[model samples]
Target chain A: MNLWLLAAAVLLVAAFGPALCVAAVAAPERRLIAQNLATVVGALAFLLMAQGYGRSPYRDAALVLAVLGPAGTLVYARFLGVLPSSRTVLYGAAIGVPAVVGPVCAAVGPGREMVKVLVIGALLVAGGTVTSVKGDRHG
Target chain B: MVSTVIVIALVLVGGAATAAVFNRDPTRQALVLSFLGLSLALLFMAVQAPDVALSQLAVGSAVTPLMILLAVRKVKRESTDQDGDESESP
Candidate 1:
């Protein structure tokens, strides 16, 4: 087993299973938060797997995830009519993505691949902020 | 080695699907379904198919849940409208 990829896979399963369980049972507003958290965790895991396997192409999936995760949350927030109302979770994710992605980019060194990693990190932070912000309508 | 990761993905997918099935409310089910889609993309990526994973992430996570929520809202609105009309008729 490739240890790093294995680690990523394990993290994914560990976090994802519980998050899904929580989303299934939690209240409406809380379920949305769990879903958003799962998206962030899943995106990070994808990036780790991409780095572990030395496959730049795999980052595309992560990139898609970083962009889409918040958009998905906002869609739910819109229809469900509830935003997170605080920035703690969002800020944590925004910080966490850069802390993880920066090291991976540095280890990979400067190149198109490093740039891609940075872009994904930036997108992840931006998306987290967008979704976590309190909206005009509070549900 | 590869199969181990694949097995993990399979387990996660199975668990998410089971949760989705048992949750039994369309709005909340939509959240579980979106998580299912995200993890499904992760599974595809783990099995060494980035192309498929990208497409799956693009459509499955965001679009599918939005569609489900919209459907739920429409059904809810229609039911409320029916309730409103019933009150008016008396």
Candidate 2:
């Protein structure tokens, strides 16, 4: 049994499943949070899958997700005109990204792949931060 | 083995799709739709189709939801504009 695959499976079943179920009935603000969190979970799962399959190219999917997930949230906030408040989401990323990506990086053992993982982690944090903040200032 | 992952993704996609149908609001439905997209992408990846998963991520995660929301916004604005002027009825 591959630990990475197990971790990814746990994430999909445990984290993403419940988050999505709740997001269904949650208020608009809560829905936004849930949706953004799902992106994080998805991206993280992709990272785990990459390691589990021993395919560096799999990480590219994670990278694309890291970049697009937050952008999608921001688009929701803009079009729907709602910005939910949640420090927990931020804190979760702050801790979760490093916690997951750090070990993966170390395990991959400093190299291009390690750097790619680190870059995806950074993108997740930065993109999450940018979207999680207050509503759009301009326009 | 991998089948477990595929099954989970399938279930989630089914749930999200049902939620999208039950939810009355276009905006919220869009959210569920986005979720469906995410799950579908996961399923694709699980099945060893990274290329399909990549395209799914782009369309499902952002583009699909954005199109729905934008359509909703446009409809609402047009309706409001019509409401502002009593002369135009319908």
TM accuracy, model 2: 0.93
lDDT of 2 by residue, A40-117 (tens): 889999998888888889888899999999888888888767677567578768888888898799889988888899
DockQ value for model 1: 0.76
lDDT of the candidates, in the order given: 0.81, 0.86
Model 1: CA > 4 A from native: A1-3, A86-88, A133-139
Q: Per-residue alpha-carbon lDDT of model 2 for B1-90, expressed as tens digits?
A: 567777888888899888888999989999988998998999888888899999999998899889888898899999989888866654
The number of clashing residue pairs in each candidate reads 0, 0
Residue B80 C-alpha lDDT in model 2? 88
Per-residue lDDT, model 2, residue A118, is 92
Candidate 1 interface RMSD to the true structure = 1.4
Q: What is the lDDT of candidate 1?
A: 0.81
Q: Please state the CAPRI-style docking class of candidate 2.
A: medium
Candidate 1, residues B1-90, lDDT tens digits: the string is: 567777888888888888889988898888888878887898898889999888888878988888888888899999999999999999
